[model samples]
Target: MLVKSLNVLILIVLLPFFVKAQTCGITNIALGKPVTVSAEQQYHVGADAVDGNVSSGWFAPGDNNYIYVDLGQSYNICKIKIIWQTDGRGKDYKAQVSTDATNWTDIFSRTNNNASTDSFTVNGTGRYVRILIATRVNNWASIEMSELEIYNSLAGNTRPSVSMTLPANNASFFSGANIKLTALANDPNGSISKVEFYQGLEKLGEVLQAPYTFTWANVQAGTYSLRAKAYDNQNADSLSLPVTIIVNPSTRWSLLGNQGTNPDSVFLGTTDNKRLVFKTNNAERMTILSDGFVGIGTSTKPNAETKFAVNGAVYAKKLKITQTGWADYVFNDDYRLPALSEVEKYIKSHKHLPGVPTTAEVEKNGTDVGEIQALLLKKIEELTLYIIEQNKKIEEQQRKISELENKEVNRN
Candidate 1:
């Protein structure tokens, strides 16, 4: 709260100057300490055309590019062109947009050899705007920047609109049942940044993006209005009319976060091919349910430690080898592909990996008295190299046959 207030104070103090930086129809964002607006400098592909003035860290000049700008506001942006110091070695420019600032979606970009002027238009939200140099030339042209022109229609139509999708508008959720909520939001001149969940005037929690879900052991038995409101990155919002949910008292299960660390943690935990289950405790991370499913990300041991889940992935932090000896690190259980050592060792000694030795060992250690269990097992892997070789031979034979048929037809 203190930091937020300080940032607001700084923005207000410097607002007039920043806003006046652009000559006409330009809004200079006063991003204070609390809000970050830059990324690391990247220098690999195109660097000749990139403007390195703003940030020398994240935006390194690649082979065919110069620099990018993030408007810091989402509008029904139509047309925008960059005026830059003329570099004679003329290249192509790309116009791109984004919502989260990380993953950029290119709307329109063009390659050009003209050193005089270039322009483009796109629709998106977020703070980043970039001009990528598509082709690098030996020499460069530096053009002086004069102005960024915007089409007039989009600037005045900022309004928040939202749509709800889930639980059928009017539905009842039993106590301890999973409740998923979804909403699509639009700002006529901006983009929705976050969604706030509310029960009456009390804020329950917040979701950063759309298609949100909130689940837990429903405790209070009554009809409650589930309200969802969306906010732009600037905290501009549109609130929805409350949806009704009947909270039953009979439901036994509830919801839990990974290790119950942060409040904004996603609730669903994956176990094997099924969803993970857990019961709530007073302080400790929502307790692991007894038998229903499994814990967060512990593929080898869930009865033991807490796992961290980023986005929707659960990671096993500590690896326990023996009763006490353990290794402290992170492991993604979903991608727990066996190592070559583990596969080779298990194939030779145990029936863990699929190999010829596994079948042979099973025959030797058969417990059934009447018949041998190993009729012989073929592994999918053994046929991989042979399949490739066979395909190549088949293609060669087909080519040879085509040539022979052509020769015979010519002779006739």
Candidate 2:
């Protein structure tokens, strides 16, 4: 919170001077770079002095000490800014430049410096610079500074580079879908201020972090060209190469991958020899053949003799079968009924009624209920006729016997 408030204050104080700052052509040569300090402490690393943030600092516990910064290469620096901690501002310090560590040339010195920030004008050309501390505001051994900035008024900055990374080149998507725009950016001599995303000439949004991304939602169907613009701290900007994408209108059905010379009919089952099988639980549960024969619980091809086949039993509330004739014809006078003796001989040989399937045949291929019912009804009608004939024969024999008895009595 404190650092944020300080940053806000710094911006407010510095914004008015931004117009003048640009003409100075000044850039921080020490920000976020390597440095060396005489004192060794975890919280007092020399890198903190050039870290660019005012909330953190380098601390040396002893007076008469110094911190060194390596610019990586030589630069003609003209000015330097020293930002100090409010708790322990350095009372006296001196800035120096050197080509080697052993020798140094002093540029500026100060005493009783009570301000939180101090600036100095210096003319120097070296790869290494140092700040030697003489005393603290309280005359204690402690020396602390939040940041150090070196500037060159004659140097010119370069534009940063930006590039889009997502929604790849020449990609396609569905209409009204959310599209994500992403980019990466870098500045060679300064920090990236912001990256702005664009569609054609119109701006979409901006992001400041790496893996920088933005979501564009519910875009209408059309072809679009996208790009990103990145700005550096120096206000110089650069634009990325554009990426093109096409969005098609929404539809109920779509095909994935390439569809070329598609099948005449797409089926949800396998086909072999013009027989298709539907499956459930990884097992074949139904089948249909090219000739329109259907089967359940099996995939075997049905022949002309048997149009429909089922491997499992079926259950229904009621069933009806249409036939050309029925057992009612058995009562017709012209209908030939087999003799009872003949039926008895056939049953003994076949182990079943003359016209019915044997037990072995029923076990192998199952029974036809309609055929069985018809056969049994015919047999019952034939049995009724046989009983009538037997009754007539017995009656005739009894009547003849009675006559014979009467005649004998008469003779007596």
Candidate 3:
């Protein structure tokens, strides 16, 4: 009996040191580590809970007071241990968890609690945990505790990080063409599943393949905030920094020329707001006026008779004319064939061909190749008819002369 009493006394002396606060299947990952703790008000300071000093801890100000903690990263939490002050026991308390700090879910809650040190079994997994005290003992207006400890196993997951590469920040472009957007993403511990692109809050598109890219075509003129979101195989996601871009309504363009020479460029016309003006070395090369008249080498509006006006020569291998009437009518039987004498008279008076332009006219206004070819064909057909008539007259005269000679021979 004396030996058994000695063993019992030793057990009673060492019981506090051997107390197993929780029976979680995992290890205590939150012990003596740096954590972010906050409260409505601190008795001394809330950081003392994770400071590993059991003698010092946090004291919240009022009923419904709460103590929140962030484990720095996500973890698979299994249990929590709360060490209260000798005089600070709570009647009601609850525990909660969250992946993000804002949203939370209750893992455990208790009522009518009276204990200096309390242990709660929690089946929670998150990066943040909080304790809410609904009521405290002695009808105290505030809730008090000496320490807050969380027992957890690391979740072993990492979210992917992403960034936009194309349409660089503050870049500008025209409204009509396609804009190619590109993004680069990285996942340290896993493979990337997809990348989603967005403009402001609206999701534009998604890409699943490598070299993640998307083309936004014919985007209207406006300011846009472009971003990309990357998702990993573990369903963890992260967003990239936004890129601001501007799309102009009207397009300013240029056509490059050889080195040391001026390029042909286009811009909105100063005189007419709707017109597009083309320039070479800052001189007017061509103008597409507001009236839809296109002029080359001049900005003067084209006259009523001209649809297209050019101030230079044009060389073409072939000229196709789609006229409604053609020179084939000159070959008709009923067509009038003018006398050669009449053509001569007209040429002498006009100082030119019967229907062709004079030298002075040709020098002043360029010739139409198609029109000249058709007129020459008409004259050739007329000449052929005149030759046939003359041949007929010659044949008649030869027959008459032959008859006369034969008659003379008979008389002899």
Per-residue error at 50 for model 3, in Å?
A: 42
RMSD, every candidate, angstroms? 31.5, 15.9, 23.0
- State TM-scores per candidate: 0.27, 0.40, 0.38
lDDT: worst 10-residue window of model 2: 257-266
Deviating ranges (above 4 Å) for candidate 1: 1-154, 216-219, 251-412
Task: Give the clash count for model 1.
Answer: 47
Candidate achieving higher TM-score, 1 or 2: 2
lDDT digits (tens) for residues 1-412 of candidate 2: 9999999999998887663333344568888878888785687677888888788788888677788888888766688899988867888888888887668888788988989989888887778888888778876556788999987555356689989999899998876678999998999978898999999999999987776899998787789999999998877899999999998665423355322222434334345557776788998887787776788876675456677887877788998987555688989989998887888898888778777787788877767677778888888888898889899999999999999999999999
lDDT of each: 0.49, 0.81, 0.77
**In model 1, what lDDT does residue 206 have?**
76
Model 2's number of clashes is 0
lDDT of 1: 0.49
Q: Which is better, 2 or 3, measured by TM-score?
A: 2
